[model samples]
Target: MKAGREKARGAWQLSLPLMLMITAASVGPGVARADAQDLPIPCANFEITYAAKPGEVIAPTDIETNKDSFWVFENSGGNLACGGTGPFTCAGLTVTVPEKDVVHPSTAKTTINGTAAALGEQDQFSLTSIDANDVTQTCKGTYLFHVSSNGGGWGDPHLTTVDGLHYDFQSAGEFTALRDDRLEIQTRQTAVPTAKIPITNEHTGIKHCVAVYTALATRVGSSRVTLQPNPNVEESRKGMELRVNGKLVTLTDSGITLKASSGEQGASIGPAAVGGIDGHIKKAADGAIEIVDARGTQVVVTPQFWNGPNVWYLNLKVYQTSATQGTMGIVPEGSWIPALPDGSSLGPKPESIDERYEQLYEKFADAWRVTDATSLFDYASGTNTATFTLDEWPYNSPESCDVPGQTPVQPTTEAVAQAACAAVQDPKEKADCVFDVMITGHEGFGKSYQIMQAFKPIGTGTWYSPEARPTKPPTHQGGWVELLKKWWWLILLLIVGLLLLLRKKK
Candidate 1:
């Protein structure tokens, strides 16, 4: 029995391919009808001419010809594309004759009256209304009709009804119906700053939720709501609220809670949160209180309105209690705001940010005058008597330190020493100027030798001078060339000779 069954199955399989071949041969060659192969293309027909003035309707001449001879009548059922017999199908009926070339006419003459005075493809339209299914409201106005295709599928001439609503799309074969509401209400779906609390509030120490609202319009109701901190000041907090269908309702306190009414009926569990309600019904996580009416159910007593701040105490108990409203429930909370930018914990303060600017300025000026960096040293009275010298170390941008008669230039060491010696009457002051300029300007230029020969004598008060010179010599160690070149060389030699006698005896 098994061998026989296998043999029978193999025979059936062999016959399958032959059956398909027989069917194809019977169909015949080139039997496809032109009408079947080329289906009827849907075309839109409308009055293309319009009145020059507004609020006026213009009639157009008949477009009957070989091209528009056959047309499937339009009805509530939709455009019918049935006629002729062949592989090429004809849908919505089309004119076999070609349309007149209106753009680039042979001559500029007015032959057809009210038949598109302007030269172009049909650029005019006729007004009509769409009343069927979910589209009930009577649409009143002119509809601009055009034909478009998405390559894979071809659509009939579509009529665009120009209603005021921007969000609603008015076209044929659309899943969504055109809304009758004003465009402002349809497209103006802003967040409105009022919604449920944010989901992250629980983690940030916010224990409460609050909401407030104020209705602005009648049919087009508008409201403002707010969420605020609850009574628990020690804990962190966050909150938000929302408005539905022009109805104001805010969530506050412990945040939002959701619960299901029945098992298997479907439900959700999540935190109470706030976000933009772009014209849709919102409900509690447990499937309660949809802000948007997607179920098409009538709602009695829209959710409570809230604006400003409110507090809420959220928990399992609150979720169960809120389910009774058939929608979401809300509460009001409040919080404190700051009066100024800085805290006053430090006590009453001065009027300005910097109260000691004036005192600081005075101290800076006094210190600058007393301590002069320019001048020369003197030995008399073992003190320096010289003013600051800029000659030896002139100002880089001399204009910075140049007085009325001073020229801007780099100061020579000799000029600086001379200026230092001339400025102060005290030998020590003069020496200090030379030392300061040399160290600061020349990177210790001749400073060591100047200090040993000039400053050391004045500092010890051993070598005295009858009068301090207007300028002082270099405070560094005296060199042989310098001693031979100036009168100071003879004095130095005498002092050395006198000290030799004492040294020999020792």
Candidate 2:
């Protein structure tokens, strides 16, 4: 019985060590595996370069104003042809008026100094036809105007007629006050021309025929004038009014219409006149007046004035389709169009891609340093796995362990990675660049490996990751090898015990 007991004890000791070794090799350490929480989150502190499309304007293109006065001219249908014939043509007329001082609160008149010239190919008529001789002449003159308030109304009555060598004209007008320091004027006038020629008859040796020609020299519609306050002049708000005639008119960006009003009219002049007696009024950038006619002809009126308190002097330049005339009127200049509020400028500018990549890499590094799982996932690819690899096992070195109160050293060099990403032009490709991070310092015994986290672009210089990290504990060092190394003495004991039992049996 004693011999049998000794043999059994030796057999049990040999098998026990082998059993423990097999068990240790099959099962791993108790610690949990490194999860996404252990991974480094990519930062987004990067800049991005963007390109603008062609003709992309960042500022406004039109002029805008809140207040101003305008001298608008509406055309009245009148045939001013010299002689009624086929292909009717009229001589172009230009007038220049010198500035005059206004005499207020009195019966005294202000005299206008100016000259008038008749132009175009139709002004050469100097012939004698039996009873009458026709002569073409240029007339120059001055206008005397007086302002009186007689309680009933205010009138700018003419003190003297516009009398020249061959023409005599008189006008009566009233000024109506409007809101915001504005005034409207309506005027009516009549002109007559007299020509004397020598006639020889059969009965009389020599005779004179006096021909008095009558024409309607009247302004049919009203004109508006606003007081433009000059910043340089104290309490100086002075302007003039204008009246022009046309059949149909429209206002366009390029120019105005003076014959038949057509095209797009941005704003309305007044009630539309039937049978093509309409006109358009537009304000230019320099406070000039643009008038268009039905035939697409334009007349630009620019005003010049001395803005003095109580009294003002005004001069005007009227530019026709091809000709320009200097006269007397008021022009409101310096109005601009409103612009949209975008940061873009009028032209294109350059942006840097390398700088943007550097910023992005820095952001990623920051997130990784904190081990922020959420931020890491957000900046990584949604479809690909966020992989992690370790050069050495966990707890192999003090720096590799996740100990309390210890910051982990980042494994990857951010500058090198960022440089690589900067070469990629495509946004998606840049975002998908591999995030190879190495974990340096961890306290726990859990093993960690190198990481390759996938990322995708989420637009507007952002990236996202979607894969979950592993949660199971890593196998301790070497699977079966480690187990055998730890329990090799047990195997030797088993071999010795088996040899002793065999010897006893022999």
Candidate 3:
């Protein structure tokens, strides 16, 4: 390869501009750029060190609010590229609207100020990479930035709804997370015993507690799947509880097609078959089952194991086209979304959590609570959604220290818990991680946050950017893509030689 490149160096006098464009289609900035520099060229291996998935992004932050340089660098790979290095030369960037529906462009009028270009068009906003793990480059494909910035809190339950509304409602019940005309998501929230987890500040004399989601159900284009906990099963058991339509099914690998099981046919829920949902009943490599409907509703449920039983927590990362109505859709205390019962809007957000509680719990939580008609859960012969609701529930979570007249208290092992969550980067996530560890005295909870940071957040179009890009660090990629990159100059040399041979024959 070195000899070939050395040989091509002499022929470099030809059209070099077109060559770079032909070979620049790669993932991220780690791949060093190629260029013809001074005298005899020294040996250089151009490999993609950092590669972000096609439309992968995390932060919904825009160029203006974020003063960060190099907002988004889109390149028509194969048309031209190269920025992670090699003589760094290229054409320009193109902004693509990921899909239909969902607002376009993150900001009202995106006017990028950096050397990078201003966001040209809309549907999908061009914004900064939210996730710290994303590798910025001038040639990586389109970065995700929902104008309404759709995705929000799977925050273990400190809900951040559609329009970025933040609040908490820990009522133990099966509630609607999201409900559109066709797409639907339901979560089973179970209150944690104060004795089990100490979310209340140390012995502050308040029976403070919180709830975590134990199961999640989704109906996407004629498919209904429930991810729930396997009760009475030992912790050693390693598998997910997946109920397709109404009957339970065991999965060995990723994808599965559901057929009418005994008693599932003609049941209350729709038909018993998995109707062409992409990745239906498919288990992700990380032990989570991911399901997506044709019309852009997506659900990824990660299994959680702790003191009680091995339950699961789900995160919905979509803002549908239709009027989304449910817990996840309602933006409480914020004027962004039409949250009021009368089809009006909630004004600016209040400062304190208690103030939010007064609004979120009273208005949205109760308003969106699932009824017998709207309820989508499997019930025992004698029980129903009422089993989860409180006979006389309070305004705010009783476990919250934010309750008026009650002073907040920190756990006795605050230091230890903080230390456990020290590795988590995001401030809010870190704080939550520390508290979870301190309250439960279980380090596993905090570790989960650390693991999630690596996940490429799901964005518009219900398309997922694979969390791990290179799978193996930019090590020796033996595939043809790498082969071409390594011997590109050699290939060019042969082409030039062939051209010369044709000219001589002529």
Candidate 4:
């Protein structure tokens, strides 16, 4: 209405002589008087053109883009222009979103006055110039989201990632676990400093700190779900509370379901059934919540009990599409901007644990850390990420120790840990559990590692045949040796044949 009134008001401002001149000129070949204003406005049909610039660089086909913001449609160039360049204007440029698109401003009616506004798998829209006599111009386009196919977990008390990369992030704060165009996961870690109780590691003397997730939140489309510790703290420790979009939700025998709007459901949450919500869900063995979005993105928010700290911290297992882009997702393949001091690429993978730690913990970790503007986790009335983010690690190295409130870790020897973790099925996990148990000096934590080993991810979410990445690294040991051992007789026959040939020649 404002744009129409502005155009009408301008049309009336025309002088009598000028109006007459326009009318006389309009009698020519094809020009016409347009509009129902007090005075006729001379113009022709309004025209619109599409441009990718001044907005997201759309995919070659205008379907895939990795952004959480809406797409922008530029119109200052030609959209709603009368006579191609006439003094015509339009406003209240609205867009029609398909139900499949769970876009922000998740409303049916969306307005994008040219240089602003966009959404979803596909959109159909129509708008007219401000002139009351102008015809409505219709437009339509399709967009399919691209996603990341790889995801991994951030283990409590023990930092781990998909790259088989591990480190100790002993900082208490919320960090962006994963984020993509359509999904996001965030974690709240609590740091445990070794300044209380007896030394946990008798061998190392225990001076370092470790962090663990205490709260986890995820956003798929517009449905935000959070699993955090129950406020009612007890010596026995109550389980976690699940909230959807800030409203506390309870789990039924069949679990809970949430949607972006009143349309088709956007996500389904349920208990860890024998088969999992039709295999779309991946429930944690410890009864953590498993969520599946329409796009088949899987998220498992789990809590682990830390006997050493006598606290329960959370962990995250994310299986995003190829479109995933956060630190926990399939990030860039070890490409660091500031080259090594000698000016060389960091190679495709880290060569050593220190190199990997520097890349993941220092460089890549900082790259994806959330700021106030981009953070998706809901904060309490008076707190934020900054409130929790501090010098979480203040103690010096164990080389020289000053004891304070170090938590007591159960004593466990290497043999004991191996035997405890022997029940774990996966050899890799068994080794890892044994290693971790030795480090923490507690056999109980072996259960945590066992659960970690069994963390079944929703591999390549929804991908019937995913793109081929590098093959798995060669096994720690084996390859030809095992094959040869199984075929010793065959080898012996070849050796005997060679000896017979040599004897015949002699």
The candidate scoring highest on TM-score is: 3
* Candidate 3 lDDT score relative to the true structure: 0.46
Candidate 3 lDDT over residue span 323-441, tens digit each: 24566565545353336444466576565666655555556566667777876666646767787675323324443423233333234388898888888897766776776667655
Candidate order by TM-score, decreasing, is: 3, 4, 2, 1
Point to the candidate with the largest lDDT.
3
- State the lDDT of candidate 1 residue by residue for 308-327, as single tens digits: 12222111001001011000
lDDT of 1: 0.21
Model 1: C-alpha RMSD to truth? Answer: 47.7
C-alpha lDDT of residue 48 in model 2: 13
Against the hidden reference, what TM-scores do the models get? Answer: 0.14, 0.16, 0.51, 0.49
> After superposition, which runs of candidate 4 have C-alpha atoms over 4 Å from their true positions?
1-148, 154-170, 194-208, 261-285, 331-366, 392-411, 452-506
Which segments of candidate 3 are over 4 A away from where they belong? 1-156, 195-208, 231-240, 257-279, 308-323, 330-342, 346-358, 392-412, 457-506
- Whole-model Cα lDDT of every candidate shown, in order: 0.21, 0.23, 0.46, 0.44
lDDT of 2 at 489: 66
Q: After superposition, how far is residue 299 of candidate 3 from its true place, in Å?
A: 1.8
Backbone collisions counted per model: 101, 56, 14, 17
- Candidate 4 lDDT over 92-169, as tens digits, reads 122322222334312212222232122111122222212112222232122112223334444324433433343344
lDDT of 2: 0.23
TM-score result, candidate 3:
0.51
